[model samples]
Target: MKDVLPYFLFFIFVENVLDLFFEEDLSWNDSFTSVATGIVSKTWDLLLAGSFIAAFEYAGTCYMWNNYRLLDYATDNKLASFLCFLMVDIAFYIDHRLTHEVSILWLGHVQHHSAEKFNLIGNLRLSFLKIYRTWTYLIPMGLVFPPQMLFFHLQANNIYQFFLHCKYVPKLGPIEWIFNTPSHHRVHHARNPKYIDMNYGGVLIIWDRILGTFVEEDEECFYGLVHPVNSNDPTWIQLHYIYDMYLKWKQQTTWSHKFQSLLKGPGWRPGSPRLGFIAEIPEPVKGDSKTRIDPPVASSLNLYVVVHCVMVIGSVFVFMTKYEKDNTNKVLALYLLLCYLSITILGRIYDRKKYAYGVELFRLLFLVAFTWTNEGSMVQFLRSICVASSGFMITKIMEPPESILVRA
Candidate 1:
């Protein structure tokens, strides 16, 4: 059997390319930030959470094998496969819905909705700090089915959901009844009070329909949170909601109120129930009043950011592929450091922070010196270009166009 990784990657490339032709407001800066944040998020999974989850699943699998042997035919029977897939889908629905209803869980999920525009790349904007609730929720399935089978279906479900993030796909007439279509997903991502907390499904819409969480899309879907993050900085996007919750916790008068403030729904108040009052939800910004959260940066800087983003993504690809075989701590640490600094610096540059110029200059000098110390014709060539590009970027940073440098 062929690996799903290649097809998944190819689909991402095609989605991004098609998005340029099909979608409006194709902000290159926002897209670059998505890719950078995605790199960091995936790296976090690989270095930490991935191993823990695998170990837990493996232990569960062994326990099931040694004890009941009830689901021994899971890998062979078609009925077993179908059941496993259904179970995974249901688990996803529960996890997605709970994340929206619970305040603490929302902290991990808010990053996905932070983007103002809904496009294919929007799927790439994930929270690096997001706690893994899906895997734990699938524990009952783990008690019966094999981990390999469950893992395959979980990945398959995710790949299917990836296509739902875009706006290009039209409503699929009859299929919309039972399956989760892109149109249904658009309503789920919207912050409009009418659509909030609706259509929480992975592969099938039957759960939402049966549970009374379904709503038909009758108007233009507005994307993003009720209160927008208004930033492209990955760090800020990841922690801002958590910080807000902390402040809310501090403002409460009693212990019960403080605990409820953090544990209840994001819209919850002292007098409100666990899910909070609907009146607390902000009205969606409509028509001309609605504005996206894009900051200004020079064209030269845009090109620079895009080029470096591609390089950083390529580096991540190399690191992940070699991760199992490469045991050198120093090499791994250096790789991680480079990826983090590259994106953080580029994000600050996009935000047009004055300190970005100085930090970037320091990074360039370090690269040039590091490359000089290494012995290779290619290394020397790279060092030479680094010197020239460093000078060019310095000039661009020092004298940005008056029009492009204006803050939003």
Candidate 2:
């Protein structure tokens, strides 16, 4: 099926809500569902809708491109316009293939294939990584096709691609030889040796056949990378590979390796690390889950938690010692500091999964030790001892049971 169905329904949902208000029916049940959660969700639903809308624009631009056919032949030169399309499209074909070969491009392109399911929502996945950061190959397009013609064609090509990212469609019959289809695309998304670098197409699949890069999809196909990125956390999934690349690049010994890592093959890693190919595919777990972790019982100090604790202690000191004077000012400053600390700790816990309640407790106290703020400038020097005590207490509480870090 076309990837637009769900998006269309969502768009309709918005319209349907408008109808209830406009039709003189002030009843709450006039629409199928309420507007607050109907039209969109804060997370994945919105991203999918955005991707769908983006793809829809591709359709509009393609319509314009097709209507403005033989775009290069302003002088009624049919042969020249066709030639321009051919030359420009060939370059696009090559660029698409290079995306897999280039680490930078893979980061973005992986987003397209990262979804385990082949539904319309899966097609909407996007990573901040550049699909093809540099379009150096397009400089020659200026020789014949005007930038406007070429630009619209590129958009049209992308719009045409949204349809191929589905599961309902079969091979394009004999036209499969010339056009891209869902089956061919399945091969492109697979990490199997036969499917690794094949089926590089935009709107047409003949490019693969012509370039000798074609590989047909068989009945058995495994999608995603060899080591599948199976997280439902969109933020984690999108940025995982990028962070891995960054850490690898940082630990790299030399500039050449660092530079080469950027252009490594589809499976390349820092040292050509083993576990290089096959993956032990796991059974899919249905539904989303929010991770809950235990707070550390002991730690010298956790950074965010420590900062959080200091504020709590500062608030206490504001009340305990009146020597600093400015009583109302001290209370206000203390209250603001403690509130800011708690909010920050909660945000940090949400983002960093391993944060257990133990960690929070330590953070709570680290916060309690920073009361010197109300002590004014005179006793600010006492902050170091307070900080150390907080750190030690956190460390004592968080010291592991020994087996935690040392994997058996």
Candidate 3:
């Protein structure tokens, strides 16, 4: 996982450049939010080495060890391997569908759809809360395939899905009929009334076609949720929908409606069907009249945030590569604290909050204090950069510059 982190970072960099060349409307703030969320989620996963295996593989290993195998054949066989892969894809289809259809589950998934611009970084914008939920659907498949094979196929399915998040790809004529293409997935991400809850397949569109959830890409997609999360804060992005659901649950007068508010589809009303009535879904407002939640940011602030974010990412790499496993709890906890603080400060800066400057000063002070005692070349380097950045921020704040301190 540590080795592959750099590659994912590179992919985001490449996508950013590509979007720039294509003159695509891109939001660096949203992209940073995705990266920050991923850093926390993936870093935690790395901290717990067994996190990649997670519940799905653990259950599969237990079942396989007990000789409760369904297939009873090794994955070395080509046909068997293909079959196992197919089963995993089917598992993803079921898991993906449930996340969309169930209201409570959608809260765990809403962050992925919260990105107004559909881009590759959007793939990294996954919910940490949604990570463990897949085992519920994938565990049953464990009866057939071994844990290793299940892990491999799941990763492959994810890799395939990652490419599906891009915008430049046009509809492939032949592949569109069977496999989940970029076009198919754009519909999946869209909040358009016609496209909502459609194309839930991970790698294969056949499951959705047969199951009747598939919708063809006929028009340009208006990406993101109908009710957008108008903030870039990773913490808020993760919690907003869950809080929204809680409010929805409280609004219901009857006990059954309260429970149903959570269990039913996101758009469900008192008299709607299990997945809600389509007629009730409003036709999405389109074109220039519709705007995304992007606040204007000064170029200098963009450079500041970008440079520090790269350092935050470098800190994760340094911890992973240099630090030992033993006696890491204290160090890891502090690292996590700085990470969250960094994310919050950066997010607030992008959102143009009045308190962001104060929070930035606090975070810099916190970093200075931690790095003062810590040993290592990387630690020293980080301390120097933090000090320099702090000095720069202080100068700007003292100026009371319109771009830095005084804002709308």
Candidate 4:
């Protein structure tokens, strides 16, 4: 995961520029929020790794079937690798399908579908709780392969899936029938009736076809959830679906009905609504005018915010690349806190909040002091101070009249 961070960052930058040049219907705020959420999620994963690994080991050992070793004959290097990759892909397909069909699991997946745009950044808008939900699927693979091999295949599967998030790739004529291409994954991300619950394979499209869940991309795709998340706040994006489930559960009168609300599909309801969360699929729309929130920002303030975002990205890259695995907890915690602060402040700026500049100023100062004291890196300290100073000066110079600012 650490090794792939730089590549992910570079691809996102390239895609954003291409979107601008081609005038694609992209949401800048949504893209930024997606990337920020990914950073937070990656940090959280590092923090949770030890506990998750222990649980995985316990489960795998307890479930290992000594008598029925299926892959015993496939011990050749190439054969073992191929078998592991195939098994992992199947596991991902089942895990993804269950997340959509089951209500509680959907809480861990809805955020990925909340973005109205289908760019590379949108692919990173994943659920932080996903690790908890998908770990069990890999336990079966432990019976056939060693843990190290299983881990390698799992990472390879993930890397392959990342390329499927792009929009510029057209459908491959013959390969589309065997492998999961960009076109197939696009249908999976669509909110249309025909596209929902289809194409769950990670690397291979054969699983979808064999299981009768494949849907061809015949028409234009409408991305995002049917019930859009209007706000760009990362915290709200993470918790909103779970909160909605809680409220729905509270409304139920019987215990069985309440449990069903948690176990059934996201569209599932108790009494009158027989649609079961899969309501009538609306026709495809042109622009995402309803969900996109692009508040007017002054050119100077926009530059300041963009520059600050780049700094945050750089900080994240450094943290991921340099931090040693043994003593990462403290640094990871502080890094995650800083990331959350930066994202919240950016959301405020997107909303045109008057106090956002003050919050950002404090964040920059805190970051500089924290880095200087912990690592004693003079170069990083000076760089952060310079960025903060530039931002402060720009905000002061572009400040609106005091009377107008006070009215808000």
What are the lDDT figures for the candidates, one per model? 0.76, 0.51, 0.77, 0.74
TM-scores, in order shown? Answer: 0.90, 0.50, 0.90, 0.84
Poorly placed runs, candidate 2 (over 4 Å): 1-81, 129-135, 250-255, 269-408
lDDT per residue for candidate 3 within 116-204, as digits (tens), equals: 77888888777777656776656666677777777788888888888898788898999888999999999999877899899999889
- Best model number under lDDT: 3
Q: For residues 1-408, what per-residue lDDT tens digits would candidate 2 score against the true structure?
A: 225445644644454465456533222111101111111121222223433444444444455444553443463456655665666567767877877777766776665665444433344455433322323444345445555555655656666676676555677788787888888887887656667778888767888898788988875555555555534334445566788678767866889877667777546655563222324233223221111112231232244334534444354445434422343455544554444344334333423334533555665455445553466553454455445655554564465444222133
Better candidate number, 2 or 4, judged by TM-score: 4
The TM-score obtained by model 2 is: 0.50
**Model 4: per-residue Cα lDDT over 342-405, one tens digit each:** 8768766766666766776777666666556555575666566656664674565367634212
Q: In terms of TM-score, which candidate is stronger, 1 or 2? A: 1
- Could you give the candidate ranking by lDDT, starting with the highest? 3, 1, 4, 2
In model 4, how large is the Cα lDDT of residue 19? 86
Residues forming the 10-long window of minimal summed lDDT in candidate 4: 399-408
